[model samples]
Target: MTDSRATQADIAACVFDELKAIVANLPDVTGCAYERAPTDAQDLPCITMQTLDGAPVERRYLDGGRVANYRFALLLRKQDQEDQDRLDARALLERVASSLAEAHVELGASRAAWGMTLDTLPHRAEAGAGFADWRTELTLKYQTNR
Candidate 1:
């Protein structure tokens, strides 16, 4: 029997959903969404995630498992009252990283074995009037046979 591989959209959806769930329980995050947040949405701490890319790597014929490389970008926008902006952003980014590191089963549509790597540290930049942007990139190799 051949194992089914998840499509790009399916993998993206599962990752987005899992991020949403994880961010919901995180403190200081007002919302988490795929792509972008609504314009009319309140100016608060939020996380917006997007799939950068995914490409086929290799396949195991014996187990019918496929390997793929995926890249995801997480943009964390935080509104801070004081001058500890960079610190705040880094804190949130750390939390996000920790959550993702522990995330194996919640990765996506397929039953995947993940090897996650952080491609970049959170970069600090101005977002809007009082908001700061912390952008982080993560790379993952997902191997799934289910």
Candidate 2:
């Protein structure tokens, strides 16, 4: 019941912008931002992002999933992917994931409390071609005040 004729880059950009907007609204924490995606990395088959808390921020990824003709990208941006920044990472990921899911852009996304990761599989429209499914995931790690 949706149009999957969109390009991976377009979808990825959508996801990234959505994520940035959501993460920007986090509570208690500040200085939240997304890293400048590798200029050449865009050519890769995944969409990578990161969230900042205080000092160094953690990285997240959203790569392709299915194969050609039925391209699908499975993004995983869980706050638990890393170890050092796992505490606050959970909350950050939760807000981000929830906002993303609500947007319903790249199809659908999943969220959680401490952390959340989404995999919007490449979908096909009524009729299309020239595209492959891809997969990617990102984890947020945080420091605890405890």
Candidate 3:
């Protein structure tokens, strides 16, 4: 018998939940949610996840499956000392990357059929006086049976 196929939403939710669980134990992570960044400064160092785009892998006569790209935004407040905030952001980024790498290996071994790839974008500080909004974009590529 063939394995049951999961819907795109199911796959997305699974990935998001896994990410949430991974980051929940990290230091300075104030919040995690599906879409919509937090408005309160207290919620700084928050992570917002969303499914950006997806498409099927092209192939003839075979179930090539679909690939979905998910985006995770890490937001943090700038400190009084610019260097300190930058350091904190970078530290957090490193931790996130490490966690994702480990998760990818574990998931790959256990799931076998599904696949995941993580692309970490450069961190940037948003404009606006007194607001040190350092943001990092993590692109997660997920594949599942079509």
Candidate 4:
């Protein structure tokens, strides 16, 4: 019989794809870029995903696997009025959190080989002169056996 276990990359890809799908469907999100930093040319109200670092989880069994982390940033254009920008950013931040919660349910139900948690960092309007960015990190723990 073929092995049904998952690898680190497989779990990472699954998480990324699921998150991308969820975020892309959110209101006002123009684009979702995978594994890349946002650039000036990217459409505003966009999200970017990049794979960060990972480490093996300490376990009593040799068949245990590693945990991978990914960084996700939501970018929006800063309006001329400060309050408007802040409100817009805050709404988007809430939407992102809600999306992550939905993703948790979706990912958990669909992928039986892995588990994920999301940690949202502070929101910042300092992503440059004209952009507000909200950042979050996703941690995924999955088996690496074959």
Worst 10 residues of 1 by lDDT: 1-10
Candidate maximizing lDDT: 1
Q: Write the per-residue lDDT of candidate 3 for residues 77-103, one digit (tens) a residue.
A: 433257777777767765665575457
Cα RMSD of all models vs. native, in order, equals 3.4, 18.1, 4.8, 4.8
Q: State model 2's lDDT.
A: 0.34
lDDT of 4 by residue, 1-146 (tens): 01223433455566667767877678677677766545564476666665565443433244433332333344344322487767777677666655654565233322343455556543664556566665555555443321
lDDT (CA) per prediction: 0.70, 0.34, 0.54, 0.53
Tell me the TM-score of model 2.
0.33
TM-score per model over all chains: 0.78, 0.33, 0.65, 0.65
Ranking of all predicted structures according to lDDT, beginning with the best and ending with the worst = 1, 3, 4, 2
What is the lDDT, from 0 to 100, of the residue 93 in candidate 1? 81
Evaluation by TM-score, superior candidate among 2 and 4: 4
- For candidate 2, lDDT tens digit of each residue in 83-111? 43343444344444556555644423331
lDDT of 1: 0.70
Which runs of model 1 end up more than 4 angstroms from their true locations? Answer: 1-6, 38-43, 54-64, 80-82, 107-110
Query: How many residue pairs clash in all the candidates, one count each?
Result: 0, 34, 0, 0
List ranges where model 2 is wrong by over 4 Å.
1-6, 27-85, 106-146
